[model samples]
Target: MPRLPIIHKTQLVASSRLFQVEEVHLEFSNGEQRIFERLVSRGYGAVLIVPMLDNETVLLIREYSAGTERYELGLPKGKVEPGEDLFEAANREIMEEVGHGAHHIQLLKRVSLAPGYMGHHTNLLLARDLYPATQPGDEPEPLEVVPWKLNRLDELIAGNECTEGRSLLALYMVRDLFMRLNR
Candidate 1:
């Protein structure tokens, strides 16, 4: 493995919020030269969770995304604000999107949404012990609250119900958590 830093960055192209981009040439003291690679960069996102009372149901949200121009069934998520910690962002997004607060937040995974063509990183959080709170702020109207049964988790996966890769990964982690809890 090599520690590569961005020598220079430039946006080669931008279309529909996805940038076909590039960075300047890279060089090492050992005299190795290579062009810096740039992928579609969305930076970062969060996965929010709410465990139902019996600890059997997980709260999910269905909301419309302008970028995709379609409704996506996913766990609550949002971009991280400047200089914000990932967990803080996750907590804030959960409250804002679902009006819920989580007591136990375990980071299940960190995923690269498109290692081939995107510089996006989605943080997966396993949140438990939830309580109601006033909604954080305005988002798309008519946010649908879906109670996802732990046993039926695969239904969503099998149905290909979720479009966000981050949400899918989060649910997969929750499934793993469920297996651990059942033991």
Candidate 2:
């Protein structure tokens, strides 16, 4: 394995409400130096929940994505609040976006969207044994909850609205796990 680069210093090149641009100065073991710019998120990470309404159906949400400037169809997800557990954040996000709460929830994986250029991480959560519930959320508009069959994930992926990489990979992972378990 190659040695990790030593970070000489990191400077804040830009700042925004939700993200900060950082310039990292580093020196490798070979005495080579390089400067890389990355986006540093300003919160405790986040959680992306796959709330299974049944053995086959998963609850999804359609909401406006500011980055895309349009509505996106994806699994319920939200940021982890300060001092909050990842599972707790997952349940809360589902309740807020899908109007449901999970009786059982487990972390599947923690992933970085763009590890090479971003410091943000999202915890993928698998939620089952769901019940109807709703919590007030900070969304500017009410979200549309859509029940989707895991078997039809290909259709969802082929659609343009399900463009979030984290959501697609999470669903694929859960689908594969469920298929293997049922075999």
Scored by CA lDDT, what does every candidate get?
Answer: 0.70, 0.92
Top TM-score: which candidate number? 2
Task: Give the lowest summed-lDDT range of ten residues in model 2.
Answer: 13-22
Q: Estimate each model's TM-score.
A: 0.76, 0.97
Which segments of model 2 are wrong by more than 4 Å? none
- Residue-level lDDT of model 1, residues 65-181, one tens digit each, is 888888888888777877778777777777787777777777777787767556777777877777786564668486887888878877887885577766776777777777888
Clashing pairs in 1: none
lDDT of 1: 0.70
